[model samples]
Target: MTSMSKSKTNNGNGTVDSRRQEVQRIVKNACDQLNSEGVDARNYVEQLAWLFFLKAFDEAETRREEEAAFDDAGYERRLSGNFAWSSWASKTDHPDEMLEFVDGKLWIKLTSPDPKKGLGDDPLAERFRR
Candidate 1:
């Protein structure tokens, strides 16, 4: 195996190995569920990747905002309010509600940017616009 793969799969700790296995199992279960619904592995993985990307972006933006606040500097957020993952994902309790938000509002916000609607001209938002 490549050194990178080996390093990732064998971290020289039983606890890490067990946790890795658990994560793998959870991802596999998710993939299986999507597959059962006629979603191909590639499509499901891409969707998962998009969700993960948005979540990570939100976390990084939060950190940057905090740092700017501490320094008494202004920090413009790329995602906030309902566009933020924390707000939409956590606040929407029901599956149907979440789906509706994603399919309707979230999709429009991401795919069709409108400065008038507050999906501003930030770098990340501009990328989505393109």
Candidate 2:
């Protein structure tokens, strides 16, 4: 993951400090909501970690894809379609569908050792297996 110091997101208007505050506010709200639903701090944090990791992975892949396009080279994505965060997580209006996809297909692809069922033999897939 890139360092926050190296890259500051202004969200197209606000300063870095304001963006930080906005993120903190969002996180606090999410924590409060999860607490009300009986999810402990540790559990919610763990789930958030998975989300953040996937988002970062998607961002990195996007960067690589752009570079490949600029260089006129072929770049195959590690994940695509419903397995990608862009394909699944971006559709916030369909929470039920997103949840079903995550539980039904995404988890299977990430965890299944059978190459036909999972991410094949990539280094990232090997790490997931561990």
Candidate 3:
């Protein structure tokens, strides 16, 4: 990661390269935690990537809320309530909870229709469904 550039993000909290490294580090930690539970390294990384995608989507929604440019702002917030990364991803205290949410419930939602959310034919939603 040190070999990567250190250009700062718009937030100025950290460099773009550093932020990617941080995500990778988090994914590694997640992989380590799940490996003991019989999850394969490759699959764990995939799971982490999916979760990160959700986090990014949720962040975009939050950004829209903070900077409301239109009535349709934050409309891309597909995941809400428990399914959102803010709820599941933020649960770092109990490692088992994170693992259970990602490994169990996450898969079911990803493949099935979320009755609570009526985001029909949404591109992101459709991708998750498949």
List, residue by residue over 33-60, the lDDT tens digit for candidate 3: 7888998876656666676677788888
Of the two candidates 1 and 3, the one with more favorable lDDT, higher being better, is 1
Give lDDT tens digits, candidate 1, residues 1-130: 9999888777777797887688789788988888899988877776677787887889899999999999999998767788889988785459799889888888676776557556464455576665
* Candidate with the greatest TM-score versus the true structure: 2
User: Model 2, 54-112: lDDT tens per residue?
Assistant: 88899899999999999999887777777889999887899898898888988777666
Name model 3 segments beyond 4 Å from true: 1-18, 28-40, 69-76, 114-120
CA-RMSD of model 2: 5.8
Error of 1 at 31 (Å): 0.9
Task: Work out the TM-score per prediction.
Answer: 0.68, 0.75, 0.59
Model 1: residues with Cα > 4 Å off, grouped in runs:
1-25, 91-93, 114-122
Give the distance in Å from residue 84's predicted Cα in candidate 1 to where it truly belongs: 0.7
Local distance difference test values of all predictions, in order: 0.79, 0.79, 0.69
Q: CA shift at 120, candidate 2, in angstroms? A: 8.2
TM-score of 3: 0.59
